[model samples]
Target: MRDTLRTRVRLVGATMAVSIALLVAVESALAHEEYVVDGERDVAVGEFLAESLTDPFVVGPLLAGAVLVLVGIAGYLVVPPVERDVGAFRAAMGEYRSYVPWLLRISFGIPLIGAGFGGYFISPAVHVQARLLQVALGFLLLFGFATRVVALLTLGCYLIGVVVRPILLLQLEFVGGMLAIALIGSGRPSADHVLQRVAGTPGTLYGRLDIVHDRARVFQERIREYRTLVPTIVRLGLGSTFVSLGLGQKILRPGIGLAVVDKYELTTVVPASPELWVLGAGLAEIGLGLALVGGFFTRASAASAIGVFSLTLFALPDDPVLAHVGLFGLASVLLITGSGPYAIDRRLEPVETEEPADAVPEAA
Candidate 1:
């Protein structure tokens, strides 16, 4: 019974994650279509819904939904019908308890850093001091996640000292990062224990209560573990869609950037030489997409991309709804999820200590 419940929870979480990912991909494809036809196009929710509901594209969502259903069904079939061991179940639950808070940190930290950089780049003179503070905050956040108590304390102090603090936003990244680390550091609960617990339980009040409490505890732990990651994931999905569309325009239509800028009347005072900037921006976006997908130096790359997108938003502030919305979404994602599973950081754990050379001690 416990094994069954645990499997059910895993299936549910995985399904939801995949579904969200598919939805984002569908939205991205639509955004690309709009970008190609009209550089300065806007998409309304109703129109988007109607269009997505049609052929070919509709298949994507349907497939994702189907996969989710299948997983749920599989979980139902595979989960055993027995009472599980309590002690082992508790141990399993404890393993993942710390993951939630860390995830929340990352989700929030990425954005706060980006916003600081965006502000810095937009008007250096005006935001120089603010930019420095933000950069400092970002580093402190990274350090905090790596188990630096001093960094965490400093962050706390800064939060209290700042009069009009954007505490919620900052906390979001901090929490997300912390949760992800915890999750990775402490893997899933013991499948064997869960199976045992389920096998032992019969249909009594105590048995039911044990099952209910275990399920609830595990569910809460999973929720806490994933809640921070979810926002970041959402941001990544939306950001990837917009960035991909923007890149598509450049690829499909060579002079799409200039055309887009002109159509949007983005530059009241266009640069005497705009081609270079446009091309550079396009290339930068392509690189950003790759970095995001690859998850290399995720926080830094995402921050830089956010800076670029934010600048675009300012330049073409009066553009169509989708453009602004897309840019906002991209910036949000970069801010929220610095880099996910695909990130290179995952493979870059520091070497704790070097092994001694293969030399034997002479004459002791």
Candidate 2:
């Protein structure tokens, strides 16, 4: 049974990877198209909109939905003469569910890369816009794949871009990106599979009881092992975000740190003179990022850093739709996941207790 499940998982992964690659190829082609022709932008836009209406945006999802239906049909056909066993059906469905994250990553990543490259090649204004879009899309992809750290970093880029420049184009981009992320994030699998696997048995009163006890023990052990580590992760995240922003702000305009802030008027957020607010914001960011990296007061640092980014969303409401969307998504991940596995929390965990004390208590 385990082997079968593993095989199915591998198949699903392979299919998902292929699907993502195909989607990326399509997006890359579109990006190249923009750079290849002069008058082609309008034509390209028209074709893209038309294609979106006819194909992947509509037809492609329909096709995928149809494939799912076929899987259901096949499962029914394979069921035995007696009562139909749902184990295999459930396994197949689980495999499909597991494939979703990979698919979303590919879907978001390819276009972002294409857009980034396109931006770099286009006029300076377009280049700046494209980079912001790239950061937003990249964060959305990472968030879709449960890589919270990567998402946060990308989001930082987006937010900084806005703080540096607050304009109408950037605002629209932010909104668009947010909507995309919302669409992707709304469909996550439940945690039930993790519980079932850890329990090592199907549903039964005794089995459930054992699973619960095991989970509780595991949770306690993990907490003891990584008590200090969790805080460290948060601190590192905070420090990195702050440092990046501080450096950027110190050298560039406050609007420069944020992309949308610069899209309109070139004036800096800090008035004409010394620009103390920009410098202060930068220093704070550096402190927060360094603290996070050092593994101190991690949760607080992460929370603060996230709050800073959230504020940027409001500060540069006129930033591009994609940029705002990306930052929002990135901030959400940092708030939820913190630093993840590599942080100090993993290192500080206490050693596991060999047996329950009651099982082998010392004889009186």
Best by lDDT: 1
Q: Which lDDT tens digits does candidate 2 get at residues 35-91?
A: 111222122334433443454444444456558756854564475333234334333
As a TM-score, model 1 comes out at: 0.36
Q: Report the C-alpha lDDT of model 1 over 1-364, residue by residue, as the tens digit.
A: 6875575457436534542343333323322223222453343434433444454444454556558756854564377332255224434533433332333333334444664666631111123335666556555444332322323443353334222332122122232233223322211132222433454467655545454445534544454433324333433443343344444444333345556656655455654233433444545565565555555545456566667656755666543322233234334444433343324545542321111111111000
RMSD of each: 19.0, 23.6
Highest TM-score: give the candidate number: 1
In model 1, which runs have C-alpha deviations exceeding 4 angstroms? 1-216, 222-239, 254-256, 264-278, 320-342, 348-364
In model 1, the Cα lDDT at residue 147 comes to 25
Worst 10 residues of 2 by lDDT: 355-364
Error of 2 at 286 (Å): 1.1
- Model 1 shows how many backbone clashes? 41
